[model samples]
Target chain A: MTFTETLQTKKFIVTAELFPPKGTNLKPLLEKAELLRGRIDGFNVTDNQRAVMRLGSLAICSILQKQGLEPIMQMTCRDRNRIALESDLLSAAALGIENILILSGDHPSQGDHKEAKVVYDLDPVQLLKTARTLETGVDLAGKKLDGSPKFCLGAVVNPMAEQLDLQLAMVEKKIEAGAQFFQTQPVFEKKLLELFLCKTKDLPVKFLIGVFLLKNSQIAMFMKEKLGINIPDEYIKRLATAASPLDEGIKIAAELISAMKPQVQGVHIMALGLEEHIPEILNKVK
Target chain B: MIITKQKELDKILEKLKNRKNIFIVGCAACATKCATGGEDQVQALSVEMSKHGLAILGSMVLDTPCDIRVVKKDLARDDKAQKAESLVLLTCGAGVQAISSVLEDKELVPALDTMFLGTIERLGNFHQFCSLCGDCIIDETGGICPVTRCAKSLVNGPCGGALKGKCEVNSENDCAWITIYDKLKKNKTGIKKYHNIKNNAAVNKPQKVKTR
Candidate 1:
């Protein structure tokens, strides 16, 4: 079933992030997608994830759809202006891509091209609203489209963000702007996720808790220190002291998913380059 | 106020390598306040340049190099400025262009990089507060401009990256949207509607205005 159809059903929705290759060699990327072909509901093809330059996500999504797989096209406001952003959405719809995940995106300074110019002409919320506007057969400026595109719009949230009140307000704003579902930043702590869920329980939307597979303690440390992700020391300690770090990482992911599965609608696993180990992690989920 | 930063001495010399004699010009206004183009800076740069073996014809700090009339009346007829092969301007881009407009024959080199339109928190501490986008929405945002202050220039609200009221992009800077949220909440104001997408036409390149 499509991701939108899955979200409407009572089944637990599952999605995983899939990044395009840096160069024209798509063997590795396609191979990774084929491994998890039927395991997940949708493959979130990232648009230059973290501002790093790569092949366009829309093309990959089209390729995935042609291969009989559901692709969630991740759109960011970091690289494209309003005109290009709107045009890309139309192109996605024409190509039969249904799911869209809107993001404000990481600033260009954070990526490979530090000196690149940022074109956040439309903020994430504004982009979500613009996508909804496109469904009405007109563009942001009320320009007519020969045919409108339909989409199941998704957005991102930071459940572990320190400023809870501000984050909740923005979540509400995203909902009002036409975000039907949200995928949060990686959450290692149960309390943080519970608090976020409790606070936003009234909001009419689905929450897919972000579960990043921690390969080792060093990566965990980097994420905690550099990326500002709230990874508890316990998980880091487990990864550090474990006999096999990768297995321990999978266990941690499985444990988090199992514990939080009842509360959240789904889990969005971010394998970060360890896509092959995703099935192992999911197998441990019970 | 306009914030300015001095270009590297090597770069300045590189641009002036072809010119014979060089003249240094500074601004006494924002450049002075920013310590990039003040009289003291101009004098220091002049001494520093001479050490690199470039012939210095003369140096002067104008009251405002951005004012075309001021540059024309003050520096245009100066003997040293007229004789110099190139003028190394310590003022902002406005100053370089202003002097270039009147001294059409001489090569004008900008010594300082115009950083941003900002406010001075204290000496040597500056914060950019405006993008000069030509569209103002501070009234709806509790006087805080998300357009200029937010790292992403998000107008609808804060991006999810803000942590502990600090921007994820720059940890030192407080997230602009959080600050705006606090102010509006303190005033007991309901969360305002989305400001919508910014009108980029208002921020068209090489913007100009006729006050009259």
Candidate 2:
């Protein structure tokens, strides 16, 4: 089924963000995509995430489409100016890649090459607006195109953010920018989802709760430091004290899915390089 | 104002490895306030160079090193400056560039790294002011700079990673967008004050001005 059909018809949808290989080789990534063939509604091909240079997301998305799997192309505002972004969007659409997730990517300062000049020519809001505009027959400048691309536009959200009201306001704005769906940051508590869901209750956008699978207490603490995500102390304590962190992580993820599955449309598992462990997670989620 | 700090004494000495004569130029303005370039700093630097047996042609703390007219006149009249082979500029990047503009023949080495244009909260306290992106979005962001302050430079607001009102990259700082959001709300305002998104494209870099 198409991703939209899965969203509409199924009781719940499952998706994953695919981390492509760092090198030029696509065989490893293509093999991984083949491994996740039926496991998700669609896999989001990440752009040069964490500001690290990688195989381009559009290239992988196009190849993934040819391989008969639905791909959600993750595009960030860090690397491209307006023309490159608009051109890439159109090209991705032409190659039959449908889903597009827009983000204001991590700055180069945090990445390997601190000297790399950032080109945030379009803010995330502007990016969303541009994508929406392109979907209609004109570019961001309103120039006529031979054929505009149709895309299922998506944006990211942080439900667990301290500024709840501001997040709510932007939820309204993203919807205004023509975001059909939102894939949120990893959430650990119910109150956050409850508050965000209640606040955005009136909006038409679909919310996919992000489930970040922790490797261990070390990884958990590291993620908190790097991403500024506040992982619940209990989860950390559980990972910290567990006999096997991997096993405990799977158990916790399954429990989290069980707890949160009823509250939202679906979940997006961010295994964070633990793609091999996903089947175990899915197995226990039942 | 642009902020900078003194380069290490060892690093400075290493740069003067082969130089027999050197003239030090310090700024009395920003560099003095930052303690990077000042009268005492120049004197102390000269003393340190003396221990290494390097002959100091002379040193002066000019009130405004970046002012072309003042600096050009000051350098022209200074006898000690003319004798020196290397000019060690203990000032901001602008000061070094200003001196270089006139003293093109003199080999000049900057003794400090230029940090950022900032606002002085108080003595020894500084906050980044502007990135000079050319397209100003401060009015929309409640007088805070999303370009300079936001870790991701996200104008829209905080990214998904901001935790507890702090930035993702630097937690000590309140997220610029959050600050903007609160400030706008307190002012009974919103993003309507900001220009359209296309305006950001104006920063297509190699950004310059021909004030001439």
Candidate 3:
């Protein structure tokens, strides 16, 4: 089934993020996707994740679709103007890439290309609305398209954000803008997920809470300090003291997913270059 | 006011490689307040140029060099200014262009890079408050322009990266959306409307207007 069909039928949907290779070599990327071919509901192709230059997500998503894999193309507003964004959307449609996850990407300064110019011509909310508009057989300029694309649109949220009201407001805006599902930033503590679900329980949308695999205490610290994720010290301590940190990280992710399974509709796992261990983490989820 | 930063002396010298005699121009308004193009700065630049073996013909600090009338009235007819092979302008781009328009024959070189339209926080510190996108939407954002202040220029709301009221891209800057949310909450204003895509036609570059 397609990702949208899976979202509709599957009780506990699972999706994993895939970062396109920095170079033209797609062997490693395809190998990783092959590893989790049927394990998850969908493969979300990241668009230059963290603003690091990489092969474009559109090409990778198309390749995945050719290989009979459901690819959710992640689009960011950071690198393209309105014209390019709309054109890419139409191109994605023509390529038969259905699902789209729109994001207001990280500023270029945060990426490896610190000197790159940021083009956030369309805000994330506006991008989401634009996708919906294209689905209705019309472009943003009100011109009719020969063929429109249908998509299972998704957006992002930060459940542990201190600015809860603004986040919720944007959540509402995203839903209004045609976001059917939301994949959130990683929330380490179960209470944070519960708090977010409690606030968004009434909203008619699916929540795929972000579950990042913390490989070690240093990685956890980086997420806290650099990424600003709210990872509790308990998990970091567990990883720091454990003899096998990778095993411990897998255990922590599984434990969190098990705990979150009852509340959220799904889990979006971000293994971060350690995709080989995803099945090991999933094996321990029950 | 427009903010500016002085270019390195070496860069100016490189631009003035062939010219032996040079004249300096300064502005008394924004550039003067910014200390990039003031009377003191012009004198300092004159001395600096002289140390490089180039002769300084003359210098002038105009009231506002961005004004073509001021450029024509204060600098157009001066014998020393007219005699210089190159005119080094320690002013904003507008000021440099104004002088260029009036003194059409002179080879003009800008000694300062015009940074942005900003507000003066102190004598030396300046912060950009407007991007001059032409289409303004701060009315819905409680007067805090997310377009100008947000790192990603997200008009709808803050991106997920903001933490503890600080922007994820730069911790030194407060998250513009959070500040706007606070101000709106204080004023009991409702941010129910979602801002659509900004029209770029109004801000099409090399913008000009004819006021009636």
Candidate 4:
């Protein structure tokens, strides 16, 4: 079945993110894929996650699909211009990897070697629009592809931004660009999530709220202060007061999943070193 | 042009664990011009590995390894998977990973360290200019790199180590502060204007943060 069909069938679809290893060792990554197989609706393999070099996402996704797991290939515009990007899209379709998460990646400077040049030929919005164009057998510049790609296009959102209106505006723009689903950054506050959803009610896109497992209070604080994430102070205090910080963090995460269950279509558990805890989160939600 | 160095080559060989049957892979992409792990680099690696008594099974260089179609066709037609015990990649980390994505069983190794996205300084020299701090400071420095220029990455004037015309560390290269000073003066701009440029303290270093 197609990735979208699978997502629609699962009531509260669960997906996990896996990054290809930095070095040539694939045993660990393959082992991770085997562990996650059949447990989640689909797994996401990031494209050059954080702009640092690693294995390509399309190749990794292909490996996952070979293992009987559905793979969602994340495509970024940081490295490729329109020509290269569209070609890769067509290739993705040819390989039967249907789900795509379009993103205007972080600059090369944000990667391991600061000297990389960036090719921001098309931003995420433009890329989504280009994908639609490619579906019709045309390129971004209106040229024809030998054969077009059939893609289930997805985009990203940061709902925890300080400016709710601006974030909502971006959502609308993504929808206009033909994004069918959106996976947001980690959601720590239910109220803010509600506010974002309410504003985007008119958008015809499925929203997947990002639920990251907090390892400790330091990580929670890092999310808030450094990443501009909005976790309520009261929640932080509650986690701090708990007897076991790890257990408290899981409790808080479960509470978030419960709160957001009725609001969005699904929750994308970020696992983030707590892949084992996903079973716990899923068990609680079930 | 594909760019590579001996250090990167050493790392890839190290990953091979000194295996004998090796298939050296190259790319027709960015590395082709920099000449590090492109077609020539792969041939060079084959010979060098053979000198170390390693069996050079064969070599192939795709137009672009990241282009899935090219890689898929090449792998299918060549059937290097059957012949070579291990594959050594000379392209960027993306290219190496792309090849790995398709060939599930074969062992893949990276021959070059995928460093920063940089531009060629002259014909052969390449230098990094921006850090992509999510904030740009090019307007203040007159388009010359302060991030890579100043030894300390100082955004302001040259440090005490700046000499008459060259940097303190390397006399061969012009001092970054001197370049900035000359550029601003030539543009009839005040040096004070450049000092007020704020560094993006919040911008995290562009290293890979594995979010698995």
The lowest-lDDT stretch of 10 consecutive residues in candidate 4 chain B is B192-201
Task: Place model 3 in a CAPRI quality band.
Answer: high
TM-score each candidate: 0.97, 0.91, 0.98, 0.57
Cα DockQ of the candidate 1 complex = 0.73
Per-residue lDDT of candidate 1, residues A1-286 (tens digit): 8888888898888899998999888889899999998899989999998899999999999999999999999999999998999999999999999899999999998999999997899999999999999999999889999999999999999998877887888888899999999998899998888899999888888989899999999999999987788889999999999999989999999999999989989999999988888988899999
User: Model 2 off-target regions past 4 Å?
Assistant: A4-11, A141-143, A221-244, B187-195, B198-212
TM-score of B-chain for each predicted structure, in order: 0.94, 0.89, 0.95, 0.76
CAPRI rating of model 4: incorrect
Off by over 4 Å in 4: A238-244, B1-212
Predicted candidate 3 versus true structure: per-residue lDDT over B23-140, tens digit per residue = 9999899999999899999999989888888888889998988999988888997888989889999899999999888889889999999999988889899998899998999888
Model 2, position B50: C-alpha lDDT score:
88
Candidate 3 local Cα displacement, residue B68, angstroms: 1.4
Give model 3's share of reference contacts. 0.84
What DockQ, between 0 and 1, does each candidate earn? 0.73, 0.46, 0.81, 0.02
User: Could you give candidate 2's per-residue lDDT for residues B138-171 as a string of tens digits?
Assistant: 7667788887888767777667567677777777
**DockQ result, candidate 2:** 0.46
Better of 1 and 2 by DockQ: 1
lDDT of 4 by residue, A1-286 (tens): 6578965664776788887888778887787777766677878888887678998998888888777788889998778866798888888888888889987665566578568765655656667877888899987556767867888889888777543443454566677778888888888877778888888877777888898888777877877765456778877787677788777777777888888887778878786645766666666663
